[model samples]
Target chain A: MASTRAVLIWGALAVAVIVPVAIAAHSPLLAWRSPVYIAAGLAGVVAMTLVLFQPLLVGGYLPGLPRPRGRRLHRWVGAALVTAVALHVAGLWLTSPPDVIDALLFVSPTPFSAWGVIAMWTVFAAASLAALRRRLRLRPRVWRLGHTALVMVVVLGSVVHALLIEGTMGTVSKVVLCALILAVTVKVLLDLRTWALLARSWR
Target chain B: MTREHATRRAFLATGAAAVATLATAASGLLVPARAQGLAPTPSMRGGANNYLPGAPIVERIGGGGFWMTGSVRRAGDGAPLQGVRIQIWAHTTEGHERDPHSHGATLTDAQGRFRLEMPQIVPAFGQPHGHLAYDDAAFETVFLRPVMPSSRDTSLSADFVLQPA
Candidate 1:
């Protein structure tokens, strides 16, 4: 019974990740787009899907996966997310260097570009800080708090960036995906007492 | 192993069928039409009777006469299309539709919206109609012949929803 339940949950999760991308892959606009542009777009989609998985895995929300395995998966997925983001940026640069530079410098005409740039930088920052945690010798709680804050920015920024772009993803599916990410992030943060820390800090 | 192979074969077959069906349905939309018909036509059939093949691209035309405003969007998803050329020509207070002075073009902004000023359209072929065209490689060519609601109106607008070629 538990195995059946786990399968059901995972199936739903897979659907959430797959449906929007499947629909977007069929967009006619892609017919004429450069391969690099298509790669960048696909990377963005994969990164968004990874964002949804990160909080759930760390929070031990998936039914069948044990906590240790989930944590290991979380790290692997985090690495994959960072790599996807790098590929996204590199592909965009190859397609349009001046536009990509403008996006990185936060002066792109498209409003979504600035939000995506902010989110991309925050993803790198979070990954770098986590990698340097031992060398920096930061206090455990402080490190968690800082990392949580950065991840929050990454989550919110990427969601907004995806929502603002008028792409192949339908609004309903995009909103559903984004909402799942946000709810999972909040649930994990609540379990960690991150909000309580903020409440105390505010006092 | 045999069962797994059989399932994979079924999946591949189903996927192929789906793709073939989609391609067949979309083939019609993929082929673009030029000017609706041979040009020098009337009623948005494109080819202004006196089209001066190269109208200089401008922000607004004719010094704030009648307002010509419109938007450009992708047909299926309705996403705002940017930088699409929208050509305009009309019989108006300043000149006749056949006159080159009455013809000019502008581009959609980042939001897919455009506005231009021209002398208010007057009756041409007994109706006050303004002509516009989108002749860019990025999208299928389109011609718009929007008629003014009334000749006295200060402004008229027409929008385009372009399909990918």
Candidate 2:
């Protein structure tokens, strides 16, 4: 029964990620788009799904992966997430530099662009801190608190960014994916007792 | 004495009327004349994306059974501008909007009107919409993405009143 449940959960996760990419692949809008643009766009779609995996793996929600192994996978996934973000931004930069500049400067007329920029920066900050953790010689508690906070921001910013953009993504599937990312993250954070850490830190 | 006062008052009123008439005429002259008695259509924000700078002209998008139609007129005077190239693209039944097969360009006829037939527009980005653009040196470029009222609509029409560059 448990094995069947694990298979079902994994399958569900697969659908959540695969459905958006599939929808985008068939988007009639792709006809005139540059290859760089398509690659960049798919990277974004993948990154949003990756956001879901971070919390699930860190919280050890997946049955097959042990917590320590899951944490290691989480780190790899984090690196992948950052790489995907770079591809997304780079593709846009190549396609439309002015728009990307506007987004980076936080002066974009489109609300979604700003959200995306915010999420991108937060993800980078989290990645940088992770890389420098040993050099900083921070305590486990401090590291967890800081990383968890940034990850939460990444979740919020990315979800808002994804939701606001009206792009190749299908509406129903996109909303479902965003909602799942949010709910799962919140659940994982709660299970991990993020608030208790905060309380202890305050004391 | 009362007759003299009345005459002075009449002279002031005539001057005021004359001044008002000239101001109205000047204002009309200052504003670009609209021959069609219609205001220029403002471009929508976020209307242009996946725009191809210069897609070649095509006779039709793809065995076009569904009509995508619109008119183009000058903003200064609601005069139809002929020989203007108008590009049309849409997510359609045969191909995605991003496909080269899904995009095509046509010229405005002498009447300042343009039309093309393409496969029926499919829901793209969640709504059934068609994109049209007037990217030429002759007029300020305008990109339009107009949504059809219903996915089942057989045809969609969008018109443009372009400002001179």
Candidate 3:
């Protein structure tokens, strides 16, 4: 029974990430820059998806969950997410260096470019903090607060980025993905608050 | 077996496997040898009136015009395309210099060489038009406007080589 429940939860998590990817992979109407660009964009979406769900995974917010995997997987996954974002930016740079530079410097004539750049920086900050938290000897609460704040920025920026990009994902899929991101975020936050309250009561 | 010996043997086996795996992975990442086999060539085809003798090459030669040069080749097999018409036109940064709509067109010569002049100016905020046309279909069309130079003498070079779509 425990195994079955675990499988179902894992399946749900996979769907949350995979469904957005599959929808964004190809659209008859939108022509991608190249196969490489498409692949990078898809990877970014998956990484963002994982980042959105990381808090829940870390806190073991699943119903009837087993003991969380000693936080090693969490750290590794966070690092992987950062690498994926780098690849996404690098791929875009290779395909269109001028546009990528404009986006990064917030000088892109396009409005959406600013949002993507902001999200990228926020994600990078969050990952860096996560890596250095141990060495820095930061308080758990402070680290958690900082991480959460930056994550919210990343989510907001990503939502806007996805919303503004007309290619591939299109209006419908973009809306769906944005909704999923919001739903997951809300769930994770609520669970975290509840866990905090429970810990306080225990004390 | 003694515990120390058993541990050493296990470690040795694991180390060997890891080394082998790393070597294999590294080789896979190395640049493939070009001389080991025939270099892969892209396929090209000609159709209808668009077919020309010799290959057509278009170059934006940095100054005023894009130099379009190619040998005309026969549609069947690999014969030089010759004499087929190739039209080239793009909007200048100053806003559609040739056409009122900011579009331009020209034809290729007998040797498959053609040149179209573009006046240096700032790129327009909107789309630029430049394409290769044969028969009814236009291929290798760049929808975005080229970055316009600030001065007339400032040169920018771009090349367009068309292949079977």
Best candidate, lDDT-wise? 2
Q: Of the pair 2 and 3, which is ahead by TM-score? A: 2
lDDT of 1: 0.77
**Candidate 1 per-residue C-alpha lDDT over B72-134 given as tens digits, one digit per residue, 9 for 90 to 100:** 888666778888888888766666565677788888899999887877676433245677877
Error of 2 at B111 (Å): 6.0
Worst 10 residues of 3 chain A by lDDT: A26-35
Model 2 residue A23 lDDT score: 94
Ranking by lDDT: 2, 1, 3
Number of the top TM-score candidate: 2
Which of the two candidates, 1 or 3, achieves a greater TM-score against the reference? 1
Ranking by TM-score: 2, 1, 3
Model 3, residue A24: what's the lDDT?
67
The residue-by-residue lDDT of candidate 1 on A1-203, one tens digit each, is 98899999999999999997887687644563556667777888889999999999988889966678888898889899999999988987775465567678775545677888899999888888888989999777677778899999999999999887765566788899999999999999888787666556532
Q: Candidate 2: lDDT of B87? A: 89
Query: What is candidate 1's CA lDDT for residue B54?
Result: 62
lDDT of 2 by residue, B57-137 (tens): 887888888898889998766889899998888767676555678788889999999988888886543357788888889
Interface RMSD of each candidate, angstroms, one decimal: 18.5, 6.2, 15.2
> What DockQ does each candidate score versus the true complex, computed on alpha carbons?
0.01, 0.08, 0.01
lDDT (Cα atoms) of all candidates against the true structure: 0.77, 0.82, 0.56
Clashing pairs in 1: B66-B118
Give the C-alpha lDDT of model 3.
0.56
